[model samples]
Target: MPTLSAADVRAALLAGAEIALIDVREEDPYAHGHPLWATNFPLSKLELEAWTRIPRRNTTIAIYGEALGEDLAPRAAAVLAALGYTRVHRLEGGLAGWQAAGGECFIDVNVPSKAFGELVDATRRTPSLSAQEVKQLIDTRADIVIVDARRFDEYRTMSIPTATSVPGAELVLRVRELAPDPATRVIVNCAGRTRSIIGTQSLINAGLPNPVAALRNGTIGWTLAGQTLDHGASRRFPEHVDAERREAARQAARGLARRAGVARIALHDLRTLESDDRTLYRFDVRTPDEYAAGHLPGFASAPGGQLVQETDHHAPVRGARIVLADDDGVRADMSASWLAQMGWDVSVVEPVDARERGERGQPAARAPQPAESPTVSVATLAEWLGVKAAEGDAANGLAEGHASRAGAGARDTRDTRDTRDTQDARAREVAREDVDENAAQRADEARREPLAERSARSDDASADVAVIDVTASANYVQRHIPGAWYAVRAQLRDALTRIPRARRYVLTCGSGQLAAFAAADLRGLVPDGASVYVLDGGTLAWLAAGLPVEDGETRLASPRIDRYRRPYEGTGNAAEAMQAYLDWEFGLVEQLRLDGTHRFEVL
Candidate 1:
């Protein structure tokens, strides 16, 4: 296999070349450590995730994994090659080689965004209030509004008292509504450092009249200072956005976007970009409901706020081009500005008639199906297990019958006739039992219920169901069933032990597909009496049904290690984790010195 030395890759990065440094390891392992800017594309999920993640077949893709045990780079390269990726190469000596070449390794995903946020704070000297000071202000009932610049679900999880949810990208668009008075102080916060800093800076950049500041150290700092967070707070920005204010925000964002080199393209130009050899991701940065109402064809629904906050999840390939679309130009413009600053070649499409565009409810990109894995239904496995159990019972019964008859003597013709009649009667009874067992199995199969029904059932006293949300930790924190517990699907074996014991397990994911697979796995693992079923339509269905959802890493059966939360996320993170995270960010400038592949220019 072709290999690229760490030095060469570093040089390319420094020279602003388009390359994707991909780490083919599971999320847990990837979170442990890797080179800066290395996107995780696990070997187990390569076929399913590669197409969308690395969309350009010829994009410079370098695959790496553990240096010692079970090298996955060669196999991962082969898979990519099979998928029509022409420029695939393995990283020389794996991650160790990068370290050997003086490249710095960092923990957690989305390091680029986090590092950039730090860089922004260091340069801009963004104003901030300590937890104690903010508390004093709140106690005094000062004229201020605490804006949590995280996703609404995260805001709901744990927030400073009285903070309203207005995610990062939305800060510029919605600040006017949340605090119309120029004298009202606006305090923006997130779980920790990045979003809070970025959010406060965004308002400053937009030239909002309010005095903007980030909550220092965010909730983590607040907790260390002995302050309490309000859990399950539902305060949010108003549903309606002011049109005139939105237009003003758009104009301001356009200026910032231009300064960051974000391009404004028409539909025809967007088509040209799409047809090029380079990969292009088109997204409609509107609310989910708005996108569902009407959107351009091939544009995925990526709410602008969440898209900016979780860019790595949306677009893993570092050098890929991204196009943002919105009916109101404000969202796309604001989102594109941040993405451009973070080193993506991003553009905002001109607003066009919604009637001319195709509408879709969900994302258009489909995960690639595994080639050799055949679908196995739960019913089939259940039936197989049932047959095995029946056979074992029959074998034991035959042994007992033989033992009981071992000393029997030969009977007269009349006794033999009676024995024959008894045997016929036993056979009829066994057939009836078989019919009843079959009926029971069919009834159990029919009980597979959707999330809505299960949710309703959960309220009943007689129901013994446990909802297992099998999504990444980050997603689970964003939004999930009020009482759902998080578990990584691939780590279900270990996760199973941590989950609460229940008579039935209802598995769910972002969609129902993974949930179905997880449910099947649960059936094999659980005891015979315990039941497992997939939550048809998953959490999305639960939300569609207007059921309550809770935020935060609530009810974690397994360790939150499934994802490496940013050093700045949540309270009570280890001092080492926080120090190590800051050390990693501080060293990124030097790491960039070695790799030179990053084309970042903080505006």
Candidate 2:
């Protein structure tokens, strides 16, 4: 593969040339440090996600990773090449090389969004309330309403004592109804800080008469102050706002977006930019459920809160133009304003008719299609693993292909079966238990017991089928098949050497998409007589089938570099790590100024 020096990547970014500065490492290590514009497209997921994320196959691509001298970077370049990416090149010395060349390395994820929040706080002097002060108000039953600015599921996981989930952009549309009286105090919070600051500032920008403030440092500050959080809380802002309030909020939000240099274009005007060579992303900024019911022809569903939190994910190209659509007007404007301040050429489509919202659910990506691989249903795989049904699960087999099939007989939380919320929740549960020694030990013991003793079929039933899980290491350690081995997709040939050879091999991952590609690759690695098949729908399907899952690191086949525990997430973080995270966030604004690539202009 050809190489690009760190200086070359820097020059390309500065010149505003179309280039993808990619980090091929998993998200965990990628979050620890990376270049400002480097989007993470892990080697483990190259075949599954690269096409949708990078968009143009022939675009300039500079790839880097911690495993610079190893087969990792070269292997990644080869994968991209196989996908028809013609200009893929390795970063001369990787991240350290970038640092040596005076490229600043930012620690933590979402640097662009969080740094912009700090700039907003500094310039707007966004008002805030300490944890103690907020706690006092809650104790006194004062005329105050606390609203969480995170997603509804995140709010449900942990939130203030009595906070309602309004999410970020919903603050303007819903806060008026939430606190009708001008004297009613409103406080906003998120897991950490950015969303709260943006949410609180959103209300202020909309010119709400009510006194507005952010819960300082959000829930992190609350916990550090020795306060408690309410788990599984379901309080939510009213979905239906009074018509008069909605119209008022729309005008207020529009004015704020206009002040921030966000353009307002009619829905029809969106066509003019479609033919431009520049990347243009059209997203419906309404809530997921709202977008699912109806949305623009080619637009994808990206709730406003998540869109702001993950701009690099939604639009990886830094110079890409973004167009947002929301029927209510409040969400698109509030979301677009923040994107504009963060140096995005964002616009909102006006007068979007009900007719335009003809397409439903999420839009499909125009990814390259590899030859489809053979698959075995989750129940069939379970049966092959010598796990007999418990008398009542005779009809538990799900049909083959995609999410809906896997979700059909979902054992628990079926409503959220296909959403990222369910997947994140499952991953968190696995991570949390893996860290708990008592829980991990108990799970290990349970899995160690024989699978043959209670099996209706002979032990030979499982002897010939070797199951390999290609999901993240954290998820693999927490939940997997009784005898399945865990391995990174990139190192399949190496991993297969370590595992006992079987006549037939089965591969699985989070949703089976990655496994499908890995299975195809595995077919080439194994002997001619050996059979390779993907577990239909992957691990999620296995979970939905309510089949037995063995937790703990039973069949260790790979290193655990796939997931990095964020200091801000969950409740078991050490005091030092949490405090250090807050301190790192505090210094971001200074770093943004020093970097000089960010074109942020606070409104």
Candidate 3:
């Protein structure tokens, strides 16, 4: 296989050449450490995810994995080649090689976006209020309007006493309506520092008339400071934008994007980029509902706020061209400013006719399908699970640990305790209705034990059929077939060895697609040649069938390593870890200086 030395890859990154430095290990391993620009594209999900993520077949791609045992680079490279990626190369010596060459290997996911938030804070001196100060202001009924700069779901999960969900990108577009009186102070917050800083800076950049400040350290700091977070906040920004406010916001946003060096390209310019060698991604940065109503052809609905915070997932290949669009004009430019600051070559499409946006709803991903889809109906799977119609009661959402790969915050549990005077560190930040320690710990520990070598337990020790749900770990915790064990698609081969032996094993994902592809891998791993089948339509079908479902980390057949647990994302994350995460954010401006690869020009 062709190989690129760590030095050569580093040079490409320094020169801003379009490249996808891919880590093919499972998320857990990949999250442990990786180069600044490396995108995690696990070997297991390569065929399923590569086309959408990489997009350009001939983009320079470098694949790597575990430094020593069971290297996955060659495996991933071969798969990419099979999937029509023409410029795939193995990283010379893997992650360890990058480390040896003095390449920085940052931990946690979405480092670029987070680090940029820190840089914004450092350079702009973004104003912020401590949790205690914010709490005081709230208790006194201060003239302030708090806006949560996260998805509506996240804001609903846990928010400050009176915060409204404005999200990051909408700060410019919707802040006018939420706090129409210019005298009202506007406080922007997210689960942590990244969105808080970015969201606050966005308003500052657009010159919001009112004084603005971020809720310092966000909810994590709020918890550390012993303040109670309100769970199930329903306040959302009004979607209606009057022509006057929309035009005003469009002018401010266009100016901000221009200052950040984001290009304003016409449809013809986008066409030019598409025909070039560089990989280009065109996205409509608007609300899902609006995107569903009408959007440009071939544009995907990636909410502006989410697309900025999750650039790695949306467009994994660093240095690739990105074009953003919106009918109202504000969302796309607001999103593009941040992407450009993060060193992405980004552009906002010049205003197009509202009539030209003919596409409705999200465009389906053209991922590779499994050769044979051996199917099981959701009703049949529910019967197999012997599920009864009993779901655990949820105050806000279920458990504190939804295994978001430790990414999204709302999926985690809410911390309702008043910790103001308490010194107990054992106090969980998340409300846990039930912690099934045995079930969760057993599956995690037993994964290394080959087969049924240990004493038989009442569960799964002697079952005729085993159902392995391959949904995103967070979704699995939300709802799943009662008796199923949660396993990530990337770790299915190793995961099956730990699960109790059964006559037949059925695999499933959110939709049946992932399960279908994974079933093929399972068929080869079964020692007894057990029949492997997929639940047609996956878990969504199970819910649609009116079948019973359960929630929480009851059965974790695979570890939640697919996503790096953000310090503020889990129930039991240490207070010190949260503090360290803040400290890390504080130091990122310096890290950015040392890296020397970024093109950030904060105005």
Q: What does candidate 2's lDDT look like per residue over 4-57, in tens digits?
A: 998887777776666788888877778889877887777877776776666666
Give per-model TM-scores. Answer: 0.72, 0.87, 0.83
Candidate 3 residue pairs in clash (backbone atoms < 3 Å): 28-561, 400-413, 405-563
Error of 2 at 321 (Å): 0.6
The Cα RMSD of model 2 versus the native structure comes to: 5.3
RMSD of candidate 3 to true structure, Å: 8.1
Once fitted onto the true fold, the runs of candidate 1 whose alpha carbons sit more than 4 angstroms away are 372-376, 383-562, 565-597
Per-residue lDDT over 238-287 for candidate 1, one digit per residue giving the tens place of the 0 to 100 score: 87778888888988988888898889988877677874466788888877
Q: Candidate 3 regions off by >4 Å?
A: 376-464, 542-555, 570-573
Best prediction by lDDT: 2
Better of 1 and 3 by lDDT: 3
Better of 2 and 3 by lDDT: 2
**Model 2: clashing residue pairs?**
none
Per-residue error at 569 for model 3, in Å?
3.2
Tell how far residue 382 is off in model 1, in angstroms: 3.1
